[model samples]
Target: MIILLVLTVISIIASLYASFIYAPTELVMGDIQRIFYFHMGTVWVATVAFTTVFIASIMFLKSGKRKWDILALSSAEIGVLFITLTIITGSIWAKPIWGTWWTWDPQLTTTFILWILYIVYLILRSVAGDNVKQARFAAVFSIIAFIDLPLVYISARLKRGISPVVFGPGGGGIESKMLITMLITFLACTLLFIILLKQRILYEKIKDNLRLLKSRAI
Candidate 1:
């Protein structure tokens, strides 16, 4: 908990300073482009959370550890928070740049679908009733749902008439300073995610322990 708190504080300070001081003001978008730091940051965190959940689910299935189950749940819950923020921030940025609050663009559509899919996963967990059933069902669904992420990323690039390029590649048209700011934002958000995940897992552990103790007392 102390580590999480410390990291959270550091992340906020670093992210804000990097965005204001290190990042260059965009000429075309002006100060409004400042939102890019948050927009990209949230999305980066969401993506990492989703990936972690997917991998952790697989590990849970293989190892059958209750701790992995807790991790999976924590990650999914945090992923939802970040993804929701990503969609909202992206919409805000889009309204100014794209002139619409939303577009049926492949990227947006895929992200929206992924968000809904995870929401359903959460609902399934609520209805499953028992730990065994919930873990099995959610783990399976997480793996299947994450399969769409790559497709979503690929479709976005294909739709834009740009072949998929690995990170840090040339010809992407992103300026070096913008890229650096994005990297900084990504790092900050990643740290924030670790903090949030730890707190959530600790909370879940406490809640579960309380429930078990209550059952025993009864």
Candidate 2:
């Protein structure tokens, strides 16, 4: 864990340098385009986090294990954090380019929905507490929420929207330097996610232990 933390810190510093110093300013959007690297990184991490939640939720359902539930909850919490960052960074980048803080573009709409769904999942988990039946319900909801993940990815391609499709037809490819920077940012974000998830899970376990001790004392 100590080594992981050290590596994550180093990766984050390198990513910042790569984004701000190594990557060239875009001819079109100028320095504002620099936010793109961080934006993509957050998006990538959120995608992984939520996918982890989905899988963990499924595992909990099949195995009926509290650890899996803890994993799902921890991942969901971090997933929400990263998606929140994604939205904020996206809005920051969108303001100058789109002439507004936000728009009801397809990708944005789906992304918003995706965010809301996980928010609801987190709420459900909190309300359920340690109840097995309620936890199962939350798990099932998470599985259903995975459906929106794909919708968020495809919305810009299938519908007329303002979000840029960067990886497919009708998309503009990234420059090599910018691509490298983006990849480094992704590495930083992923490492940060792993660290956060580990801490969160440990915290949850400690909390449970405290609760158990209090009950026994009572």
Candidate 3:
């Protein structure tokens, strides 16, 4: 835990140096374009979180293990947190470039949909009440929801929009220094995700143990 915390702090400082000092300011967007560093970083971590949920959900369905269920739920919680950051930061980044708070752009819309879907997933877990049923339902829903991940990634390509493409084929125009900063920030965010996910899973385990103890006492 200490190691994870230390690494996260170091990465964060390095990422800040890389973003603010290393990268050149854009002529059009200016310094606010620096938001892209952490914005894309959050989005990348959120994507990883959801992907973990998808894989853990599948494993839970196959093995019916309580540990897998815990992992799926933890990943979903972390995913929601990161995705929310992504949306908020993206909005802030968008305002200057797009000259508005929001537009019904394809990429934006798809990302919102993905966020809502996972929020719904979190709700389903809480409202379902029965632990076994909740886990089963969430596992299935997580698997279904992940179908949108790739779609979200490709949304810009499928539809022309004000949103820029930053990855995959046909994606270019980013300078080398900016790219390096983004990569470092992305790594830092990944480490943050690891710390957050580990903490979340540990919390879930403790909660389960407490609930089990209460039942035994009864």
Candidate 4:
């Protein structure tokens, strides 16, 4: 736990300093574009975390192990946190570039849908009576819902109507420095995700132990 916390802190500091010092400021979009670093970082990390949740769910079902369920649950929670930030920051970036607060762009739309699905997954877990049943059901839903993510990306890229490609190979815009900063941010966020996942899993183990102790006391 201490190691994970320390790593997270170090990564956060390094990411912030790197973005400020190493990353070049955008000439076209100006300082406002700096938000992309954290924004894309959050998105990239969240996507990976969520994908892990789906994979963990599958493993849990096959193995029927409580630890796998705990991992899936932790991943889902962290995934939501990162996805929330991704949406908010992306919206902020969109306002200046696209001249709107929100749009039904392919990426945004798919993200929003995936967000809702996870929200439902949480709700389902809360309402379930038995731990085993809850884990089983939620795992199923998680696996099914995550399948939409790749499709969302592909569809967004192929269709290309409302969603604007802000930065990338085909975007036709963006400075090299801005891109570097975004990549750095993404790497930092990935590191943060690893740290958080470890912490959450540890917490789950502690909770399970407490539950066992309480039941014995009763």
The Cα local distance difference test for each model comes to 0.79, 0.94, 0.88, 0.80
Task: RMSD for all candidates, in order, please.
Answer: 2.6, 1.0, 1.2, 2.2
Clashing pairs in 4: none
Best prediction by TM-score: 2
Query: Residue 150 error for model 3, in Å?
Result: 0.8
Q: Write the per-residue lDDT of candidate 4 for residues 1-218, one digit (tens) a residue.
A: 67767876777787788677777776767777767788878879878988898889999999998888888888889999988998898788878877887877676788889889988887776676356877699899999999877866776667675455665444656567766666667767887888889889999899878989999999
Q: Residues 98-179, candidate 3: write the lDDT tens digits.
A: 8887778888888889999999988887776457877798789989999888888798888857667887776756999999
Worst 10 residues of 2 by lDDT: 160-169
The model with the greater TM-score, 1 or 2, is: 2
Selected candidate, larger lDDT, 1 vs 2: 2
Question: Which digits, one per residue and each the tens of the lDDT, describe model 2 over residues 1-218?
Answer: 99999999999999999999999999978999899999999999999999999999999999999999999999999999999999999999989987888899889999999999999999999999989999999999999998999899888878857667778776778899998998999999999999999999999999999999999999
Of models 1 and 4, which has the larger TM-score? 1
* Candidate 2 off by > 4 Å: none
Look at candidate 1 and tell me the lDDT of residue 116: 92
Candidate 3, residue 95: the lDDT equals 86
Which pairs, if any, clash in model 3? none
